[model samples]
Target chain A: MAENILTPEEIIKRGELVFKKTKLMTDNELSYCPGCGHGVAHRITMEVIEELGLEEKTIGVAPVGCSVLAYEFMNVDMQEAAHGRAPAVATGIKRVYPDKTVFTYQGDGDLAAIGTAETLHACNRGENITIIFINNGIYGMTGGQMAPTTLPGMKSSTSPYGRDINMMGHPLKITELIAMLPGTVYVTRQAVHKPGLVRKAKKAIKKAFELQQENKGTTFVEIVSNCNSGWKMTPVDANNWLDKHMLDYYPLGDLKG
Target chain B: MEDVKLMKGNEAVAEAAIRAGVDAYFGYPITPQSEVIEYLMAEEPHKRTGMVVLQAESELAAINMVYGAAACGKKVMTSSSSPGISLKQEGISYIAGSELPCLIVDVVRGGPGLGTIQPSQADYFQMVKGGGHGDYRLIVLAPSTVQEMADFVELGFELAFKYRNPALILSDGVIGQMMEKVVLPPQKERLGDEEIDKRYGSWATTGKKNGRERNIITSLELKPERQEAHNLHLQAKYKEISEKEVRLEKINCENPDYLFVAYGSSARICQKAIQLAEEKGIKAGLLRPITLWPFPSKEINKLAEQVKGILVVEMSAGQMVEDVKLAVNGKVKVEHFGRFGGMVHSPDEVLEALETKIIGG
Candidate 1:
């Protein structure tokens, strides 16, 4: 009863409280474009890192995409890896110093396309690290381009006529693929388009990090993030669309569970 | 009175790593190199010696694990075949860029892609020519014997830590899988926690302190000139390394009209070819390289002064031949012979090339 002392609303406030308590480096600059899901993801991750007291030993690997300069925002001693190889680099960190808490922050284009092999292998091999994959359906850093997670008929800078399933096939179900791998002990899919969805995504991120701390093999968290700038939608409108169109194709829930 | 054992080159690398106080081992299962990981896992080094052996999700992850551990001043290593090594290029370059000391054992196989699981020396260019990106050179060790496979672990670690660079032990299927005698090195323990933190704590994310500055490892340079200067600095270090790090073996070069140069499995076959040629009254010798990037060029050049011709044998088409020619400086003609995509060149193939090309009619 005491453990559940804080409800979802209170927990978000408690996360905020934790953020203040840890005194993690905060910024109003919010490097993410307006309507980007990165802000929500960043808040939740920092809250968890603070909550679990991982600030001291935690080493975050930020990928090349939009979050290339994420290390600037986070208070922890973070390392930036080459595009799409964050998980691989995180694996290196975790194995080298099993004592440290290692996590990788990656985007859809980086994780699903250029880093497909590294992502699949890290999951299959069961590396003892955590991966936070931000899937916004399209590449945000290099303007809007088609991504593996981009929905069919989703138009972008590269895909002018929408992502044709006839040619590009389908949006890759990464979490679904990860669930099939024996190495992945914890695989979950979450969204940050709504308050309720934000809470669940936080839980998933926390759980994935907890799994690594418990040495429960590899853990993966797929966050259905929003790219307001790339999507040409306002932040609030992007979240609404994420709740509507993106959720229909992605469908939030623990794919592994 | 050491407990001696005959082992394959891959197994020897694992044993040597253990002896050299390697704190961590991360790798994926790729052919010609999987034995190293298998031996470490099956032997349970993690449980027995407090070592950390992990099978990473992918070659990329495995190499990153090495990067992480090496950041903390821990002696770390990863083993992979050619394709797997290619997957590791990004991380390798990052590690090199970060100036972290680590060991990478590449059990080369043939091919431009998914080449044979068999042995090949096809990755010479990738390994010696900075396979990853930017201005960087891995300290490469091409071991032709099972003994050197184990021996090079300490030597590689010494060089890596000394220069804060990645050291690669290059081998092929023939050497990686073949069983041969090896004299074991003395065992050492990984640096204790205090020493680890002391040595690497400056840059490694060991813990947070109130007053100390946060340390970050990255290769990203925003300004064009800054990036260029950083690359130039790395090149200068590489040039210094090249000047001092050349490792070569000269055999019977007295009045030599012909020189036999080879590496990894190809070098072993060339060794046999040289011996056979000598029995037939041909004045030929072998120039074998222990370090590939800081190539044995200086010694090779010195030998080329008197030798009429040099035979360059490798698993790939002609990657190392360029370096050989550059070393020879056009004084003596250099010809190449071997197979690619995991095909190990036999001694007969090498001898045929030697007789037809270097020895002449």
Candidate 2:
């Protein structure tokens, strides 16, 4: 029996490669934990920017969270904003460089809680920018603290007895709220736990950027992510839990366009 | 021919910003400084120089907006009164730590917390002592006249970019509201895209083009050693600025037995006080600080050796007085006197305070 063999260069020359990382991403390793949705979110966002050939004209604002150093991975001109101020910062950049594509990557705590005012006002003002929000139900960077998105009965470091609705306040469905704002031309929620879902989430992100280019208004894409390390569960268990619980609360699909 | 205009201090600063070629102005309305945004809005600078004038949601948003623009190497600025300035401290610290060049104008009003809408120098400590967190220094310029208010808009941007540091034009409600004759500088064109690329391309977050690496504007350094190194670099820059940037004016100091240390509106009041003292045969001199942070410490110390006593005048209870005392260092007796919480001290009151506080007491 004769076995056919091909060199790596020949495989690339023949365009037979299965997958290649986007050049818009840097060589630096992602700071997210294994199986964490942040890595996927970062990858897809970069892939979208690469697909649109906006690597040179894009400026990204990174919020204070596990991805505070998103600038380290996203190979583009970037600014790290004070906690929850990414929307306002992105607004500033977009207004000054109306021709440049500007976007912000923020987590729930940085977007829905401490930065709620900035986020809402930026959206309300119809800023021509995109906001990539990651909702993981818990504060991943600050060690599993209960976040504004923490579901009822969810256990976190701050909520040792599991979240009580009355005491901890009900989970915020901020995506739906943002969709209602006139400034937001497009708003959607999607997950990245499965291969099929990751593709859909990538589509949403790409669409958001496209709308931003249209100068329509604020474009928001929420990635319902899982934080296994902060959730104190195995990656598989976290995905299972997110699918069973987080999905019911933050159902996937576009709320506005 | 000089374009001379009789304008209010706030209006002069606004006009000066347009002529100085500021790229953008992000501000929110606040007492004592509301004219800044109002004037900019009415002038429609976008038509004049393509400047982006935005009314932000709040002072916090305004300052952060400035942070974003400055990171891109744009000449951005913001203005607010004391209470509003308090809200911007966090963003100000971030801008300082990131070492981005921008201007912040504080048309100061009285305040421990919204104390009054009237002029006060209570923010002297806040401006010169690094109001926000971290070890950082703002290049503070105290403008005593509307001309200086107009002049400092250009000068502030110059020093801010020269050192890649945040520069503050510390005015007061009095100067901001008072009308004065100002020779506005000629309109210089704003920096074009190619100019910005040529000038700040190395560090500014102006698109990662021309095959260069992505530029990041952040103050975070997780590594302790690296953070320390960044702090050391900032300190060195500040030290160099202090050595090269101390600005002050000496009036009637050729020989004097009594001296006054003041800045901003207080400096103007002290000038009048100087005239009154001379009439009373006191032979008083005035030392006015133009740059409050590089402070006129060395000069004040030299003068302390000549004068019998020194009195620091400010609208605050006594903020800059502490710095004056530090400069005098016990060589001569130093005293402080001022009307607090929106009250303006008259020339008669200032001379009387000099006689009673330093001379008689």
Candidate 3:
């Protein structure tokens, strides 16, 4: 049995290695909580940039959330923006460096709550930049507070009993809102929990970036993600909960691509 | 002879920015300064010099956009009025903290809140005393004329990049809207990526090329010790600016019984008041601070020795007078006289205040 199993060196020699980490990601360890989808989302984005050979020309805007430290992980020229200001910053960067590829990484709280104005306006203006929005339905970095995408009847730090739609209003379907904007050429909702879903999400991310080179307008790719620590659940349980519940409201597919 | 054009202060600024090789202009339409963006849109700077001019959703977006472009080692600017400037303060503070170079033109209107569209210098304190949060300073240049409006665009950018700090052109409605003869500077080419890399390669986030570490533009320092060290570095930069960039104009300071301290449009009024005071057999002088942040404190201290009294005139309710008082240190009498809420003081009123408040008192 020991002789039958191929050694690590023999596997490399046989070219059986199907996957490896992209060079576009730095060697620094991620600071995101274990089981958080942000790590997956970040890795996919860097892989897309690396595969597209855009590492030298890509400029990323990291928002004020758990993903705020994305600049430390994504090995690209990065500018960290104030909470909810990533889209405006990306607009500025793209406008000045028209030939460079620009994108913004924002969270549900940053994109749908504090940054709604920036998100809507930048998309409305047809800024030729990609926006990767992570919708975890809760504020992970701020200790599981209620977010704009938090589901109804969902319990959070702020909503201990459950989210009250009558009082707090309904969860905002921001990707749907973005899809309606004339400036947005492509808008999609994706997820990356399972291997199949991860592959699909990566394809969507690649399409969004490829569209950017065409100068079509704003391309928005939202990854419906999970926050195990925020939800007070194990990583495996969080993915199961997301599959059973989050998919009901945020059905993943292309909205306008 | 150089080409001269009779242009409004705001238009002159827009034209000067285009000629100065600005990479982008992001702004919103605000009273007293809408022409800055309008003229740029009309002139189509992109067609002229491949410059990017965008009308931002609000002043908040405009300034953040400036921060973004400035981070990439590009020359960018934004213009807004008093209330709009207040909205921009957060972004301005971030730019200062990040040590990015950019320009901000605050064509100030009268304000406590939505005050008036007419010119007022009430924002003097806000601009000079770090309008935004945090330990930082903006290199404030008060442009007194349409000519200065155009000239300061070039000078402001130069100083901003030299120190890697934000430079503000503080103009009131008078200078922003008034028409005057301005000798427009010759157009300069926008710097290419190669030139930017040569000049700002050490810091600017112009992409991680040439095997260098990825450049990150941010104001966040989580560590308390590191944050304190950053604040100290900013304080040192401001101190160096104060020592070398104090700018002011002294007229008839050779011999004077009294002096009028003013800036921007108020300085022009003081010039007339000085002549009127001379005609009344009273020797008066004017000291106009061109750079408001550095404040010309030392020059004011020296002038206090020769003049019996000093009257600080402004369109606001005497904001800069405090700076003058701080500099004078009670060696001579320092008084403030002004008309508030968009009111402009006439030469006669300023002269009367000087005689009664400073000379006679």
**Where in model 1 is the C-alpha error above 4 Å?**
A1-22, A26-30, A112-129, A172-222, A248-257, B112-118, B209-211, B271-274, B338-356, B359-361
Which portions of model 2 show Cα errors greater than 4 Å?
A1-15
Off by over 4 Å in 3: A1-18
TM-score per model for chain B alone? 0.96, 0.99, 0.99
Clashing pairs in 3: none
**Cα shift from native, residue B201, model 1 (Å):** 2.0
Query: Across residues A183-254, which tens digit of lDDT does each residue of candidate 1 receive?
Result: 888988898777898888888889988888988778889898888888788888887877788889888788
lDDT of 1 by residue, B1-361 (tens): 8868899889999988887888889888988788999899888887666788887777877887787667767788989989999989988999999888899998888787886888888888888888897778899999989999998899999999888889999888888999999888877877887787777677776555454555677777778999898888888888889889888887777778898888777777777887887788877888888788888887898899988889999888888899999999998889998777667677878878888987783
**Candidate 3 on A1-257: residue-level lDDT in tens?**
88989888888999996679898888999999888898889999999998998888899999799999898899999999999999999999999998899999999999999999999999998999999999989999889999999999999999999999999999999999999999999999999999999999999999999999999999999999999998999999999999999999999999997
What is the TM-score of model 3 when looking only at chain B?
0.99
Better of 1 and 2 by TM-score: 2
Order of the predicted models by lDDT, top scorer first = 2, 3, 1
lDDT of 2 by residue, B229-297 (tens): 999999999999999999999988999999999999898899999998888888999999999989989
Per-residue lDDT of model 2, residues A1-257, tens digit only: 23468777878899897789988888998888998998889999999999998899999999799999999899999999999999989988888899899999999999999999999999999999999999999999989999999999999999989999999899999988899899999999999999999999999999999988889999999999999999999999999999999999999999998
